[model samples]
Target: MSAPKVTVLDYGSGNVRSVVRALEHVGAEVTLSAKSQDVLNADGLVVPGVGAFAAVMKGLKDVDALRLIGRRVAGGRPVLGICVGLQILFDEGVEHGVRTAGMGEWPGKVERLQAEVVPHMGWNTVSPPEDSVLFNGIEDERFYFVHSYGVQHWDFDVSQPMMKPPQVTWSDHGGRFIAAVENGPLSATQFHPEKSGDAGAQLLRNWIGRLGKP
Candidate 1:
């Protein structure tokens, strides 16, 4: 089979090269595009970001990438978010006392981690939910994380059968927070898979495999 065509959205934030290299290493034909239209046709779209919430949102808005993500997701297309990429999928984010609206794909807000030490950097084990595709073969491994803010709790409705509950992975520093989430065609991770070494590679492979499925 041919490599999956993955687009690493470049909205002027985050380490786009590292993400491109990592995706290429995992059997993906990667393209780093700033154009919003590129994401629509990709087999999978990766939204990677680093820096403050409002700033990153501005970058996304500048390139109209936020609308692209929302449109693709609404069509049941596959989209993956990394770090702040994951955080912005929620309703809003609060950083340094500033509240900024997010893409609102999911309910909740990104807030500062309650940990004594901020920017929860380094490798940490994740507790993946049962039947998690993102952690299929690499559930026991650790992934790299570097951030001071995150979604402290999941806010999706679990009572509706039509809206299947997302598979959530949890990790902790001072208190538990969302590590990863798999919701239908939408998936995201609080950790940086591009910097997580071999374990991260396996996770990418899993996601790539999903891209090839019907």
Candidate 2:
């Protein structure tokens, strides 16, 4: 079979090249583009972001990428968000006491980590749910993180019959916080899998493996 075609949304967010390179290394035909059709027609879409929450949201709006993301998820297409990309998937984000609205794919708020140390950097282990596809073989391995704010609490409750709850992964720095989330058609990570070396590569492969599955 041909490799999966994946689009890395190019909305002026830094650290995108590494994400593209990582996906390529994982056997995906990666394209870095902000074109509407490119974002919509790909087998998978990756939204990578760095720096501040408000700034990232602004950049996404500038490119009208948020609407495209919503449409993709609504149609049951797969999309992955990394770093600040993950943060903007929520209802809102509060950084440095400033509040910014998010895409609201999930209900929750992203806030500063309660830990004394800001910007939880370097390698850290994650706690993936048993059914997590993203952490398949790398369950006990560590991934790289570089952020000060994250969703400290999970507020989502599945109300539909036969609908499964999202698989949430956790990690620790000074306190426990959300490390990753796997909801149908939508997934995100607070860490940078592209920079996590072998473990991260395996995670990307795991995600890519499920690109067209029901």
Q: How would you encode candidate 1's per-residue C-alpha lDDT over 91-171 as one tens digit per residue? A: 999987889999988899999999988889999999998799999989899999999999998778888877778888999
- For residue 55, what is the lDDT in candidate 2? 97
For each candidate, C-alpha RMSD in Å? Answer: 1.0, 0.9
Worst 10 residues of 2 by lDDT: 155-164
Report the lDDT tens digits of candidate 2 across residue range 1-214.
Answer: 9999999999999989999999999999999999999999999999999999999999999999999999999999999999998999999999878999999888889988889888798999999988789999899998999999999888787788787788899999888889999999999999999999999999999999999999
TM-scores of all candidate predictions against the true structure = 0.97, 0.98
